[model samples]
Target: IARIAWLSMGLPLEVAATTVDSQCGSSQQATSLGAAMVASGMEDVVMCCGVEMMTRVPLGSNMKDGVPMGESYMQHYQPTSQFMGAAMIAEEYQITRADVDAFGLKSQQNAIRAWEENRFEREIVPIEAPVLDDKGQPTGETRVIARDEGLRATTLESLAKLEPVPGQSIHTAGTSSQVSDGASVVI
Candidate 1:
């Protein structure tokens, strides 16, 4: 992402580039690092950018080699979860399934309204997204996507009807974070 932005913006190659990963906090970490550089007088201006192509990379790719839950850690701790951990936390906090679903419904509705009102027009950069057909094969066509692909027309009733993973509570696809593909840049 940094390289593409550098070349596209006609920046010289001498400028240094660094990428940081803090899982869900990656973009925030990038921005914080950039700010630290500027604040410490090590740099005048720094560009921070983040990109996650979930369609290509998907989730849990980093866990292919297994999570680094060492023997001592595993002995004391339950197996770590990704999304399920959040669901567990919500349940522990006594947050009901209906509450989560209602929040999801409100979020989707707000996102839809934002797009309809053109609130994202200024910040969104159009991307040439792959055009996939029914079988998930590329159709040799590309579409300029300016809005989020994961926003769905949802309602409280619809969200309420979805089931959580078997034996789990308070979490379903409708109440969970949607899979998304997106990139953003800042200077």
Candidate 2:
């Protein structure tokens, strides 16, 4: 997929194949590592890519036993800290439902506009999936998927109506980032 993506984007082969992982900052770390490699005379050029198919892979599946080990460690090491998404973000930034909803709305609007402008075409490779009928028989044609699946036509009214997810006091599907499948590359 990376190879195809790079080729489609007209990027050079020297700017390919490198990988990095830094939890949520994998792409940033990839850029830093690439820059360091070039500065240290390791390579002439490097391509850093980050692809998180969060929708396909359940959260915590990559971690050992799907456990919140980091939370446990923090609880054991620092009793005062509560390690969870909503609590952490809310405590850190005093984030409210309004703030989160506003951010989500902005994100959705930007994504929609980008899609409309065809700004993503240069990097997106339309993937074809077999078309199936109601009974699951292949219709002999393919359906192209070119857009990000995370986007939804949303409104503040709809957002305001959503209840927070279980165990989260300030987060809902409307106010939190969507589970998405996409890849990105930097040269």
Candidate 3:
């Protein structure tokens, strides 16, 4: 997948591929590893990319073996611990449902404005997707998927209708980050 992304972006093969699995900190781990390798004179130039296409591979699917737990650990120890975005953010910031709703609304508005202004053109590489007619025949032309898939125009009233998440009862779908597909590369 890294190779495909690199080639698609016209990046060279001299770039190294490092995959990290630290849940939310996977990319950070990859970056630290890359830095260490360069500091040790293993390679001067490194390309690091972190991708979590939750749509393609849902979280916890890769952890079928289950997480470890024992009597030595308490409060934070569980056989299958998974942290959702809203829960973690709510716990960290003591954010309420109202605050989350407002943030979600702002994100949607900003993302829409950015899309309208083509603010992402420089970073985006348009890929051709097959265009099929109603009869399922392919039109010679292809559709461009240049924008993000998660942004949705929402209102506070609509957001308020959502049920609070379990445990803290602070997070809702509106307040949490969208389940999305994204890829980023650094030189």
Residue 163 displacement (Å), model 1:
1.1
Segments in model 2 whose C-alpha atoms lie over 4 Å from true places: 1-18, 60-83, 129-142
lDDT of 1 by residue, 43-124 (tens): 9988888876555543544234555767899989997566578777887888888888888888899989999999999999
Candidate 3, clashing residue pairs? none
Q: Give each model's clash number.
A: 0, 0, 0
Clashes of 2: 0
Model 1 alpha-carbon miss at residue 86, Å: 1.0
Q: Is candidate 2 or 3 superior in lDDT?
A: 2
Q: By lDDT, who's the top model here?
A: 1
The predicted structure with the larger lDDT, 1 or 3, is: 1
What's the distance in Å from true for residue 131, model 3?
A: 9.2
Which portions of model 1 miss their true places by more than 4 Å?
Answer: 1-10, 58-79
Return the TM-score for candidate 2, rounded to 2 decimals.
Answer: 0.68
TM agreement with the true structure for every prediction: 0.80, 0.68, 0.62
Cα lDDT tens digits for candidate 3, 1-187: 5667667788667765556666556667677888888899998977776776664444434434533444566466543424355467667888777887888888889999998898988978766677778764788878887778777888999989988655556667666666665666566
